[model samples]
Target: MDDEQQDGRAVRVERDTMGEVEVPADRYWGAQTQRSLEHFDIGRDTFVWGRPVVRGLGLLKKAAAQANHDLDLLPDEIADAVVQAADEVARGELDDHFPLVVFQTGSGTQSNMNTNEVVANRAVEILGGELGSKDPVHPNDHVNRSQSSNDTFPTAVHVAVALELAERLQPAVDGLVLALEAKAEEFADVVKVGRTHLQDATPVTLGQEVGAWSGQLREAWGDVRHAGDRVLQLAIGGTAVGTGLNAPADFGPTVARHLADETGLAFRQADNLFVQLAAHDGLVAVSSSLRTLAGGLMKLANDVRWLASGPRTGIGELRIPENEPGSSIMPGKVNPTQSEAMTMVVTRVFGNDATVGFAGTQGNFQLNVFTPVMAHGVLESIRLLADACRSFTEHCVVGLEADTVRIAEHLEDDLMLVTALAPHIGYDKAAAIAKQAHRDGSTLREAALASGDVTDEDYDRWVDPAAMTRPG
Candidate 1:
């Protein structure tokens, strides 16, 4: 620790802000990173930036340091020490002690510095030295040796997002798929009219409609998983903007092997180091797939909510959970809050896609200018979507019940369902009779009875909407 006199006071050991204005002592981070926190404060959202991404990145560095040490690329002592410190931080041995400033530095230089300071301090302490002592395994010289901001920043982003998708997104999607499938089975016996442009004209099983949503969700889950698979494309080998400017040629493959061993993931060197260094398109690609999944989920959730509207007022078939009083001015008024929350999360995911799109465009010749924002945005989107899916499934979809009386009432009054009777009465006669039935405010069976279009026994035998929409 260094001490100095400033403003007639004794100042000991300059405080690092990672990027913001420096502190005399007992501080970390720097001026620019501090300035960023205040300058780019967006708005109070239910979902904000989180510590997991940063923590995951720290783990990545530790793991990387170990790999590099084992590869003989860096000093074994430093690598082992860095890995040890990182392991402590990872296992929550040092809670909130990994002092990363934030995602700043155009290429996250501040965050890199933050990592350097924390690891260096921890290592110094482990080596029987004072905190912040840059000796033996210097933070940048040894711990971050053979790496650069261009590659490290994006690499960490990939690791964090990929892990999150594997650990969080997949399980939630599985839950959603099962929920939809269960609903399909529950409503399988109830046949109803199918509509085009809200104008019903044919028969359909309520189960079949719900089953379609299940198919859509299952496909979306596959897309999400495919996108995650791409995230395993790590950039650790392509150092310093892909020129390998300061990196050893043999270092790349060794580090790759180490990463594969450490992560139990299929990590490998980028075939084209140039592309990996100068751009963050891999993350953009993965995030875009997530956005697509979010879009499908939004449609499915809203449709379920609408189809499950009411026991007396709306579509009134599926009954969502009564979590809270939906209306302040009315009694027994429950709303689709779970669906609304899912919709809101989808909106944010879509919005993050726009930012990812913008960030992609901003990647100039050798680097992208907006790394921190892009990574932060995408990470937040993934987390929110996963959380929303879990909440919606457990609180809303899983507990949903079917209202029998409502389905029966809708089936009895639906004149559009005359398409079921078409095979017996002929199409033109069925259409004419359905219009007449609606005008006369009678069941299609009664209207057909009055119009002499069909006999009661024939209506029963041929006009069964339940059988027409059923799979033969």
Candidate 2:
């Protein structure tokens, strides 16, 4: 019963120096990959390394095969097979084969070998050979030619992060900024009472307030873009310890050219692959920039939440579109759901950045043992922020409206309008007028006129809310 198991076809034996492993027969992965699966029985989360990293690794192998073929380092037939198989991986056709967790070996050697074995087996199949043959396409000797996990893993991180930022996050943030800019222009003339320390102080146009948020988002976008520049310098071709022992002198630049062509971004070899491979400061820089962007998003979301607080009892200066039922029990309640979602997403981004910062400093000597965790943190942050920006723009910012009537009503009867008179009249006189209005429950206009602090003509000219929003 145990000798020939059910169907006797589920798995086959694959051998490495450690021992033989029974790998699933249908899988594109081999011995080391099976060992990783058996050793790290961590979680069910399959996409821990994300799609971009997997795809970037595929691209790296594809480019390396071509470079090796061009330099006459590998045979043309085998190179063509490897290239075709790698392209399939890059297009996400082989995602199921990459099932390693994010909690693998610190150097990501297991993950890299997983990729190598998958690509090699698939290429072997394409060349009309049996799986795990190491025949026409060997995992390490052929598929992983002139590379090591130390260099390739970090290179894949940079490629994946940079491409995701330029393609997804940048466009989403651009949309948010444009939405806020349009709102600022639309609300330019709508004046409202301004507060400091949660108390009324002066008047300002609602456009100016919205414009401030737009400026913050633009600055955040700039920081992210600048950080991406650092991420474009890759650690590939460094091989074992940045010495490029097995790799040719031209391999790094040649692969960089291929990557630049494939991604449509200006990628280059790292100036010092030793430093890049040893330290994850490049990832930390990008994470820090994302943290700054998240901070800006938090401020903007809070402002929106406060501005659209209530229709009756709260500071209802703005109205957000009600996309869903606010509560299950409360029948007539509406909430700032989009702003709330954005704030929560920003909080997660902040946490992810902190994780990235901690992982970045975990480098010991020649290599960082924290690549998997660092990649997970930074990639998740980018993904969440991109989606959050799009959600905030579509659900909240685009459909927002100004409460012109409420704004005007608050601006007219406000005692803070006396601030205008403080310059024309003495401070003591203005204070007396304001105090009398407050005590007698009269409007500032009535108190000022009765007290004869300034003539009615001067009061009308100086206390204009629209004029107060600008310089004298």
Candidate 3:
């Protein structure tokens, strides 16, 4: 290591396998991270190191160190220092030290090295050694012992995705389901005209409509949960390729056990280390489930906005929260802003699903080269869906109210109510009655009474809107 000055600031020269490079004196990242920054200054999509991926990496490194110590592969002092340093990284205390972008190596080698360097340097500091000295602990031999980026990065991704789905996205979906269920019960007696092909069909209680939306979300939540479960199998021991190589046979299972204990998740070693390293099918499944959820959320939001279309001129069957001005030019206008936001989020999730699916197909041979972007896409989808669900539930679904007067008007005027007459009067005569009412602009009762096809008492009994909402 060389101590140097650059632009009147203190700098340190760190050497990797390639050569020596200058890293900022204050940052913990070393030569490999600096090389990645200089070469792949590609995008603004840097990993937010304080989020799940970095936290997962930190937790994984700590587990790896503990496993190595338990296996007698690492000394106790080095393992203790590394564990403490890795814990700090896991808790996001060292977030600023990890400054790599997500678009680096496809295997995320640079990011894995970044973690190793930060932990090793910090551990060295803990042992009263100079930074970048490689004195007490080597980034590879000690900190990254018995692991490779090919295996470690994928394992970290699985841990991150599983934890995120369980801790954030699933809870948000549950909250939305509960909110819609409450609305369903609240509007149990509200009768409204139903539409098919954008034309009036028959009467239905608002409760039924809201309950259907809740059912869709509950199903989607289950799909996401099941998909998340598939990623709990990790690829830790698969070292460089599918082969265990330098790592012991029990290394992967040992690390996974430690991780499970730390995170309270059911993490385990993958059944096939080769498949875990080569294909991202598990993450693809998770993304597909998220896409399904996005579709459901889109339908629910569109339905809400359509039902709450207008207080004066449109459907006007439901009222939503008036959070802010809907338009800059129109006064007293309140648009379904939450619905619009949710639909936009759905579109993004759809795009992410496409990215993840395509990335999953790019596994060349021994290892997938698209792990970093795949991780980014899946994690972004989860975060966006979780946040949008919570926002929609709080700002829109919880505040929904039925416009009873408008619903009554629509229900009373709908000509499809004539369907209740079809079984009483022959279908042909019922059709004629609806056609006559539409042509003459008369009520169904007036049209039927004039036609001598039905009696007033029969019309009253057959066309009860509340009774029409249920089976006879």
Model 3 TM-score relative to the real fold: 0.98
- lDDT string for model 1 (31-109, tens) is 3333444554544221114555565557767866876776677676677778887766545555344343334466776
lDDT of 3 by residue, 1-472 (tens): 5778999988999988888899999888899989998999988577763278888889999999999999999999999999999999989999888888889889999999999999999999999999999879999999999999999999998988998988898899999999999999999999889999989988899999999999999998889888888999999999988799999998999999999999999999998999999998999999999999999999999999999997798898989999999899999999999999999999999998999999999998898999999999999999999999999999999999999999989888999999999999889999999999999999988998988989999999888888889887
| Clashing pairs counted in every model | 15, 0, 0
Q: Considering every candidate listed, which one attains the maximal lDDT?
A: 3
Q: Cα lDDT of all candidates, in order?
A: 0.72, 0.88, 0.92
Provide the RMSD of all predictions against the true structure, rounded to 1 decimal.
3.4, 2.2, 1.1
Put down candidate 2 lDDT per residue, 1-472, tens digits, no spaces: 0112336677767777887677877788989988988888887544434888898888988988888888789898999999998899888999989998888888889888988998999999999888877777899999889889999889988988998899889999999999999999999999899878878878988999999999998998899999989989999889988899899988888888898999899999999989988898989999999999999999999999898888788889999998888989999889998888888988888898889999898888778889888888889999999999999999999999999888888877789999999998889999999999999999999999998768889888889898888998
Model 3 regions lying over 4 Å from their true place: none
Off by over 4 Å in 2: 1-9
Q: Estimate the overall C-alpha local distance difference test score of candidate 2.
A: 0.88
Estimate TM-scores for all models. 0.89, 0.96, 0.98
Q: Which 10 consecutive residues of model 3 have the lowest summed lDDT?
A: 42-51
Output the TM-score of candidate 1: 0.89
Q: Top TM-score: which candidate number?
A: 3
